[model samples]
Target: MDIKELQAERTGIFRDVYSNKIPKRVPVNLSLTLEFTAGFGNLNMAEAQWNLSLLEDAADKLCQTFYSDSCPFGGSMRYPSYYQTLQSQSFIMGSNGFIQHPEVVGMDVEDYDYLIEKPFDCIVERIIPRQY
Candidate 1:
């Protein structure tokens, strides 16, 4: 379904749930976003593929390498990105293998100069091999 249809369905389901009415169908919230991790630096198909694979592997194992500031039970359900730093305040791994820092990017950088001083840690140590 498209965005409009999805939005309408979500609104309807939310209203129904709030009103204690049984929804016609069960609502499943599959929220996903895109994350931009690593770049191949303008390489050919073969080289690009190699770099892309490496980035994907790095992103896949991000959660195991770093710990978020908040606990799982906390209100924050943030997921760490593949190219994120361990000290990042908030991060998420996008569906398209992109590492996103929505909170930081959306904030006023002038007010939050601390972010500039402490950028997220780029995990290059665990990246995939180009040969693969």
Candidate 2:
């Protein structure tokens, strides 16, 4: 089959599954993070994430390693630059290139009354700034 026929077949398989019908066969789908996928290509996760061109090798490796029905080549869900620019206190990049969310106490006990009185205002004005 050509590319369009293959795409249509894949779409039909998913559509059948969603519509409560058995597909032609089980769709061998998988979910993987860019950090994890980078390993298959022997890539530095951090460097590959920032230097987008490096992802071609990873995509090639992913196809070779898995028989998934489909996979997306896209940016990491947690972008390092956004976190760095925002001075994010909650989300930080780990040594492994994965984003980590640490426990944060954005508001003090004394601010409970303020939070109760103006929840949205308090969160937007004080808590988000502290955490992000």
Candidate 3:
């Protein structure tokens, strides 16, 4: 089938499923991760997200290799440069180019009162400052 036909069929599947109707067949939805796409294209995870052209080429190759009714290009999920620039301890990239989220406790038990008193302020000032 042509591209338009393929799109329509995919949309129909989602539409029917969301409408609480049984589709002609099960919807085979797929989700890709940044690391997976980077490895698939032999690209640096950090660079892939920063460079749109690289991501586009990799995405094209990725879709060609993997058959999925629906898949969002994974590298768009995170921009390592942004996180790197921010010096974020929450999300860090390793030598292998994979971003890892380390376990971090932004608030202590003693801070619970402050957190409860000002939820948004606690999150933005206390928690987020600690994270980024």
Candidate 4:
């Protein structure tokens, strides 16, 4: 069934369960990334990301055969950028793939007064969204 049909079928069951009624089958949400979730099953990263239909086929077989109801969702992994400049710090990965913390370079601001008075455009360009 499609998502709408599935939702219509399961919504009443979920509402009853929320009201302390026993559900025929418990729900599960496996919030795992495509890469990390490959560890659980016999799927490779490419298979999980590039070929989602195949991944779902494999999941369906595994779930039905093993009586498993686990569902996995893709997660994101963001990598930090590198900056090597006079007024900026940088991070580098070693040959063994070990990353070192960022090292501080020269002072970015010489005077607090000038920095505080600088216009918005004069500030460093925003690369990432601000998180709460």
- TM-score top scorer: 2
Residue 53 lDDT in candidate 1: 53
Instruction: Tally clashing residue pairs in candidate 4.
Output: 0
Choose 1 or 4, whichever is better by lDDT: 4
Lowest summed lDDT across 10 adjacent residues in model 4 is found at 123-132
| lDDT, model 4 | 0.46
Candidate 4 TM-score to native? 0.35
lDDT of 2 at 129: 87
Candidate 4 displacement at residue 129 in angstroms: 9.2
lDDT of 3 by residue, 1-132 (tens): 999998999999999999999998888777787667777788877676566577667677888878788875554466788898998999887776677889988998877998899999888888888898
> So what's the TM-score on candidate 3?
0.82
TM per candidate comes to 0.24, 0.84, 0.82, 0.35
Output the lDDT of residue 69, model 3. 82
Clashing pairs in 4: none
Candidate 3 lDDT at 88 equals: 95
Off by over 4 Å in 3: none
**RMSD list, candidates in order:** 16.6, 2.1, 2.2, 8.3
Q: In candidate 4, what are the lDDT values of residues 22-41, reduced to their tens digit?
A: 87777554455544444446
lDDT tens digits, residue span 31-128, model 1: 22212223222223223223445444434344234343211111113344323445453444555433345544333335244445543421121111
lDDT of each: 0.40, 0.82, 0.80, 0.46
